[model samples]
Target: MLTKPKILVVEDEIIVAVNLGQKLKKLGYDLVGITSSGEEAIQKAEENHPDLVLMDINIEGNLDGIQTAELLRNRFQTPVIYLTAYADENTLNRAKRTQPLGYIVKPFESDQLRSSIEVALYKNELEHRNRKNEESLKSTLNQMESGIITTDENGLVLFCNPVAEKIAGLSYAESIGLSLTKILKLEDSTSSSYTLPLSDVLISNQTIEKNGIFAVDGIGNKTAVSIQISPILNTEGKSSGSITVLRLGESDNTNQSYLKEIHHRIKNNLTVISSLLSMNASNLKDQETLDIFKDSQHRIQAVALLHEVLYENHDLSSISFDLYVRKLTDLLFEVYKVDRSKFKLVLDIQTPKIPSEMGMNCALIINELLTNSFKHGFKGRESGSILIRFSLNDEQYFLEVKDDGVGLSDDTIAQTRNSGSLGLSLVDSFVKLLRGKLKLENENGCKVTLSFPTRHET
Candidate 1:
């Protein structure tokens, strides 16, 4: 019930062509017209595209069968099976360069011919399946929530899904087969091991998961993104390079842009609230209530600053930590109007941009500590020294704020401190929000050190 596969025979000898055609016909194949010369085979192939071609090496044509096969392959993707009498080393070595599907030696029987054709057809079917698999894989990569791109062993991109294209600010044509540095637009362009998973796959011949920092995109946006990549191995577990998945905090094209606009307005409203509090604080005769209002205003601005940054960038996933910290510090100094001559505020801060969630938490904690130091810690004087150092250790980050002023009471911040404590308790809450630890040291002054683990990075 199956339809026979059409095959063309390319033999320079007339007798050989006739016999091959008869044998192929008898074997249940559709006998496409045979050609005696390489030139005729190429012409016939152009006119009538057969399923497969059986080529002869030493033909009576201007071009040999190998040359004809190369032409057919380059022009038409048709699979070729070489038909020859002898398996000479040079002939076979040269034939391999053309990637022939099958080779038939001379003085072959009907079974040999039948077996070669069957094997060639099987190989052709497998190639077809591989192509389909690639297409399907491409579709799946496109549908993923994260960006996905794969490269060959040489780090040349083989595939880049739609998400990868969109997130990386590039089209597939510009991405495929390109060196990752060229595509990623890394600053150093030093082919760093950003693709750790891809390397693991190459070494262990298995899947690997990795993370690394990507520089700002080619558009010179002054913003960098993190990339999470993994390896894709073959059936035999050979290193086949890797696929990188980019996570940009769910860019909901349908409504994310619209929602970001609304959040921008809300941040402005918070700023107005801070302004009103500042006016009210100026009018208050009682210093305690005035201090309370000022502290609350600073906290509101902390929340508002995060909103403002996210509003401007509209990337809900990550905010610029370096920008957020710098801006918040500036705002605090301006609000307090502290004398720069008498007291100095030192900041040794460093961190890459992070998500808005992490940024807001960090800003609030810093705001509270700085506000507390200016209030109770420096009760009698308007001049003092405060040093803020930011450092990371292993999986944890340390925020140590040291002030040469009065510190907390012994019983107030004891190891047995309870949830009953109010302001200190609030500080504890902020620490918990960061999933970190907090310790107050009262050596010469007040030393507030907050230690917490880093969040999920690329």
Candidate 2:
């Protein structure tokens, strides 16, 4: 009189079959087909189309329960649950390979059977939701313009979307599971004094940030990237791993030309204005007033030259030291016009990536030292050799200018404390900005040495 619940029961034993059928009926479920062999179960499942199949692993025929479930799954998409007497791991594992919906060990309670079925259904629902979420996440990540790379506890890259793989010049399959240092060629980035922030995410389990020049691939591409590495905590609030967020863009270039041009124009205008002031000051009797005007003009010109040079460079971030040095030497040549036999400026240098402010400091320091040589040391002749040596002195950079003409007197050395000359005072000021030491020795003519720490490595 009851509405039947169709089911296929696959068991090799007759007693177990009769008991399972009786139990399902007592639980208000119908037994549609009961078979002794896997061959019969598959045949019955194809024809009967039961709601579920209770399959036994050990059967009477060539095919086992798992094999039969696989065949039924392929043909009818029907879910299978195994009811086996043996709890041996290998037999259970074999049954699991077919992706059975549930498994029940024999000598089990009726509730155990119900629980497995309920849990299996719940897991199936969860898996369906997870699949949809995975598809959505993958689509969004692929559409992103920037890169996204996620790492595991070991710092090995676990996930890299399309953009990341493209930027890194590797396939997603090849990039995943590879250590970040080796893959990004960041070995050299941390090869120097600085350690890359990505390395810290796995160590201290803390978020770290890094911003500077990252010359991966080569200097030609030279894309600037800001990286944020944060620890990924599991549900238990423990550090499971880290994810590195990278935002990349080109470095500042527009400011380069603007800065240089503005300085160049200002320098030219100051030069003309200085000439007018000098002519007017010359007409006055007081030499002190004339000297004041000259000092102000020189200070203005110093800042002006900095602007011109910066505008010429493509990268506004820093300056080219070699070019700056040559420009100053040329300006000194025009001012003093020191003959080849008098004070010749010799340049010996080896360093790179000088900060903009530091490079300007270098220019002003050289200008002061060179001007002093012409005014004091090289007073006798317009031609004398002045050796300018720029050497790397134990992690520091040093600039030494030496002249072989007339030496400073003992009185000149003692009296020249702070205010004796504007040249010496300016040199001291620029040295302070560079965080360097400035010393003037008058043993044989005069030698000025300025040493400072480099902002970047060569």
Candidate 3:
């Protein structure tokens, strides 16, 4: 239910005050109190917090009704209507300065007084709502991440948010009344003769956006930023002002930093797992079981190394395959305890960089092939050479691993093809997972060739 408007009556005459109170009650208004003096009227207004004050110009006490109304308006924003017998030029002029909402001469009718009071209350309510909305709008703009600035039709700055103040290198007080160009010094990063399209936005009454621009500060420092300017139209659908929004273009740096941290954490976790496997393998006595643990450790290290490379490099999407292969071979040679003078390893890698997923698969495949050569093919040989070659052609990758050692016999080759051995079985599975073809043969020793289409082709 809606509450009736509370009204406070201030009049020196006892009859007039009582009559006004009765009139308010008849009109469905709540009578807060009646006072004959200005000082008592202010006290009543302060206590009651009335919606409207019917203040008489000629009241008792040292403080008159006009002075009391001014104080009430300044302190509590209370709307007032003048009820006075003095309608002379001097009294009316003095009353106007107090800014009363309505004025009623002596001996006024109930209808006239009601009309004035209703109009004042309606206007006051509208003003209250407008002030509330403006405060809400300011709060929202202040909390926004992007810099927001509003300017008049002449491009003079009217308001700016905290972000705008920081980006422009100026305080809110300093930015106000300054021209838009004075507050914001922006230029195209790729061109020198570029100018802001503020005029176009205002004249055409359309939003204009520019990216890859540099925002220059007062101290001659430039920040990469993007901006959008939109016209603020009035009720007549004409341009009244403009709103400019500024956004930093280098926000991607934060995302890249996060990605690097994620890669580093993944690499560390993988390293820990590899270390655990190595520890378990140290306690194993059986040669076959020990070799299996060691192989698992090496495979984990392959993926861990890829993450390590990604963490160290600026590009997180792909890695230098050649560099990765060199590191992996050195690691494998050290793990196998191969004498540098007796064993030779040759790497002919033509592919520079490949996606991380593809690189991980290739790394594991190479690990298997090299382990097989060091364990079975070179088993009893004091000296041997292994060659690993990788190249790209016709939207496909070719990888060849050849070793000059004891070659697999026809029966052994047939058994490996049937997935008789665990190592060879894994190799077959990996080749099929890559959607590639693999060939195993004996050319001077043992040779394995695998080919797969590029990642995009699949």
Candidate 4:
């Protein structure tokens, strides 16, 4: 059950107080207390914490009803409605200063009293809700990772989140009333001289986004950040303030070293695993089993080499595919013991560096294709050439591997589609992982083409 809106009546006349309490009860409001003095009103209000206070300004006490209402407004934020016989200019002006929600003459009708109390209650509820919402918004802003600062139209700091304080090296107490220029000292050597200050942006009612900007703190530490500022407008659509968002720049050296270390560790572990495989293969007397171990070792080596490139290069996140392919082909040549005089390896790797994961997958795919060509295509040939090409367009990647050797028949190609060859199955899974299409054709020699999106399309 919902409780009634409680009313505290402060009337000196006993008859009038009892009558007013009766009227409130009939109107569905609870008469929490009836006090005859200002001092009793304050005590009763503190005890009951009524939703509304019906105060008689001419009440008997050291603190008149006006003074009590003023104290209640400041301390408890209790809504007040003045009930008095006095309607003179002097009394009205004094009550107005107390900021009472409603004023009614002593002999006011029941309908008038009811309407005044309802309006005051409704307005008070709205104010409380608005205050709660503001607190919630402040909490959310303080929890954000991005530094946010809001300023008044005059560029005075109105609010700054906790992240903003850390980024600026300034406390909220010191920053609250300071100018934005003083609190957040921003400098941009790369920006043009014509670039406007954030204050100018506010005045122009324009939004701005700038990168490579530096913020200098009190201790003289400079931090790079990307800044975005937008104008905050009022209901009239006029600019009222500005909201600034700052994203800290990447930790270039620290991030690069961390990523490089990860790749280095991965490469070392893979090398150790491959060494174990090689040792196990040497003990195998069966030629077919030995070949299987060798194939697995080569696949591991292919992925290891990709990590090695990523670890050594300045770009830790990606690998230079062109240089990587060259090294990979050379390593394959040494492993297969292919005589340079009998065979030629041609590479046209004109693709940009790709992420390390993608590079590893591509390396393995290339390893399988090259291994198949060397093992089957050049089975009885004295001389042949293997050509590898990789290129990228705006939307997709294109890879082609061709060999001028004995080609397979159409029937063989069709049968291989259903064949459970481990190497071919790996290639098929990799192609699907990349969301790509593969085409194999034999025009005098074997030619394979694979195309896929350059970026993952989540």
Task: Give every collision pair in model 4.
Answer: none
lDDT of 1 by residue, 1-458 (tens): 88789898888788878988889888899987798888888788888888899998888768988888999988988889998878679878888998899888877789999998999999998998998998897777778866677888777888887556645555677788887656765332354534333455556655444333444543343223446655566787666677666655433455667867678688779988999999888999998788678778878878888877665454677765555676787787777776767878787764434556766776787887777777678889868998887766687778888888898778766851373434566677778888888888896788988888777443
Query: Better model by TM-score, 3 or 4?
Result: 3
Q: Name the TM-score of candidate 3.
A: 0.51
Candidate 1: stretches off by over 4 Å: 87-93, 139-145, 153-156, 162-215, 222-226, 236-239, 249-256, 259-458
Better of 1 and 4 by TM-score: 4
What is the alpha-carbon lDDT of model 4 when measured against the actual structure? 0.82
Against the reference, the lDDT scores of all candidates come to 0.74, 0.71, 0.84, 0.82
Q: What is the lDDT of residue 124 in candidate 2?
A: 59
Error of 3 at 86 (Å): 5.0
| Per-residue alpha-carbon lDDT of candidate 4 for residues 335-402, written as tens digits (9 for 90 to 100) | 99888778998887666366666777777788888888888889988899998998788778888989
lDDT of 2 by residue, 224-331 (tens): 556677888889776687876656544554554466566667778877887887788778787777766765666556666676666544455666566667777777
Per residue, candidate 3 scores C-alpha lDDT tens digits across 333-437 of 888898878999888876756776777778788888888888889999999999999988988999999999987778767666575667778888888778898
Clashes of each: 3, 8, 0, 0
lDDT at 102, model 3 = 86
> How far does residue 277 in candidate 4 sit from its true spot (Å)?
50
The reply for model 3, stretches above 4 Å from the true place, is: 61-66, 84-100, 190-195, 255-458
lDDT of 1: 0.74
TM-score of each: 0.48, 0.44, 0.51, 0.50
- Which prediction has more favorable lDDT, 2 or 3? 3
